[model samples]
Target: MKNLDKLLEKYAKLCVKVGINIKEGQPLVINAPIEGLEFVRLLSKNAYELGASEVYVNWSDEVLTKLKYKNSPMEVFENYPKWKADSLEDFAKRGAGFISISSDDPELLKEMDPKKVAAANKSASIALKEYRKYTMNDINPWLVISIATRSWAKKVFPKLEEEKALKSLWDAIFKATRIDQEDPIKAWEDHMGNLKEKVDFLNNKKIKSLHYTSKNGTDLKVELPIDHIWAGGGSITSSGVPFAPNMPTEEVYTMPDKYGVDGVIYSTKPLNYGGNLIDEFKLYFEKGKVVDFSASVGEEVLKDLFAIDEGAKHLGEVALVPFDSPISNSNIIFMNTLFDENASCHFAFGKAYPTNIKGGEDMTDEELEAHHVNNSLTHVDFMVGDSTTSIVATTLDGKTLQIFKDGNWAF
Candidate 1:
């Protein structure tokens, strides 16, 4: 691929300045793909320039991961290394900023043992459960960004050669993140303001529940917890540092009531979950649980997903995105959740965000459960909205408002 040195620099700057908002004297922990080593070098440089005290990199290689999974014993997947968990937790304790560059191959683990994959994921989640709280509760600033890898790019543009596919995917990513603009940071500020408007309006509505209907056979009702906070664009840590959790963010989301979702919903896009794709799926929800589901592709993977834990059978998040968003208008299914979920309204199955509820960070597990917050080892988002989708909200006081009509903001 041709080098875009300046463009890559701008991207790293935007992530450092706006994504994690690297604070002076604050340490940074970056999880990047081995393929992105050059990018990581640029990121470390940018972070240091912004006065980051130290930068730590944890490099991952999808090829290696798949190799290990293909040959490793099942027992190896059932136990997580204590030292790895300790390192992450220690970083969280020190108020370090985290940047995770997710660039997994959508089909990296296809045909691999689903049992091993599921078990390892579950074990890792359990090992780092406490570390997750820091990110989930906004206790520390953390950001999730994506990079174009050969495998991922090929999946997105299979007809193109590897180089062309990479360039195309990179162009799309830069466009989606506004990094292609002359003043990308300024553009993001303006975009953030637009998203904030929607967040403020939804917060003021004091919505009790939402009813979703669409031509794609989605008809569902989802209830929100009392005092649930709608957040988007960026968030502030308890200590006041600001950070954007995801690049190319377009949704203002909050947690759903664990036991308050019911009806049927159809997926509008394929879900590349943990290296396996699940598409053309329909989930039947009853009392917030996944009573049943059907997926034309990867049905066994779907079964292994919710079977990770009890909370996997229920929804933990409800995010609102418009069908007319920038990414949606691109008309490309990236097959990556970080981008796809931003393109349309989606729901996640697994643990809820503590930051979504008032004083939720301080709430005990039992108290959170009492407040209808679901807990699980997984938080997988699947798109379920399109141009024909409509959403109506009912406020606590009985007034109703059209939140989305024909898949775009109606307010």
Candidate 2:
């Protein structure tokens, strides 16, 4: 018990020091599940100790949410509380750093209607579009980290008892985030440097497009926009504050032109979307749109996912993760995108981050649209890389360079 408490404290401190890089006098906001309240309290304490002027928490309960979904009318799903949306906007306006703790059962909403879930998500996103723009543009630092709950742990390690599974999952999370290291902050700094090196290498190549192929029926071509930037590791906010958006991040990604993707790709891992598991899925793209798709499970959910908005059918982000990442090597199916997406190469459908385009943060919506950047209320990532996959880059100068072979960077 003592060791567990110590681990949680250390993890919270790492989040405060490195993940959000909380600045002196900065207000901090955390969105976390009720199951993660212990860690949230620790994080709030750590943030205050690190010079945060104030700490705000937006606590959520999965059971309550499920009950609401089950009992609420369809019209309720369409309404997003203005007060909640305003609060998030206010946080961005005040330059408050944001931290989100993810720890929900993957199947928490499996019994609910997919359309209603999609409606609720879409409505909320629309109501908070301004807030989304602020965060997506990196106006303020934001970090997303994960915690282990009993239900989530059980999903991961079904064979183990509840207590044992929770501990095992916690151990896995700590190791993946390098929190198990003697000096986790220093370890992260070194890891960030290594990732930056890879980004620099890709940027120097000035590739105009990428071609992916595998024996698993993936033959895709993704065109990169002019002045596109491949970003990962730590990112600096508009005010020059540095923060890591996702802990245990292994992918350096860029936005794919909204109208520039063409191929048929198969998912290498299952995607747990809104507590629904989508597996054995394949997407057929034409001119950057998902013209067709099929999934062995959660087919209705997949259909509803792409129907969120017009931009939902277009590609937003293309990320490259080595097939040999620490999380992938662990041989654990977390059933969570936060960890699973980092385990393999993936692509997102919906809104693209403005930071991925050159001078994009300051660009007008029209300008961004002209640059072929996607804009939508949703961003869903699905794994698509494995040992059988290979990626090659085609430079503007007509040079073909190998990027990945057998799912690892070839360089």
**Candidate 2 residue spans exceeding 4 A from truth:** none
Residues 335-395 of candidate 2: C-alpha lDDT, one tens digit per residue: 9999999999999989999999999999988999999999889889999999978999998
Q: Give the winner by lDDT.
A: 1
Query: All models: lDDT?
Result: 0.92, 0.92
For residues 31-122, could you state the per-residue lDDT of candidate 1 as single tens digits?
Answer: 99999999999999999999999999888988789889989999889999998899999998998999999888898889798899888888
Clashing pairs in 1: none
Q: What is the TM-score of each candidate against the true structure?
A: 0.98, 0.99
lDDT at position 243, candidate 2: 89
Clashing pairs in 2: none
Query: Candidate 1, which segments miss by more than 4 Å at Cα?
Result: 1-3
The ten-residue window of minimal lDDT in model 2 covers 113-122
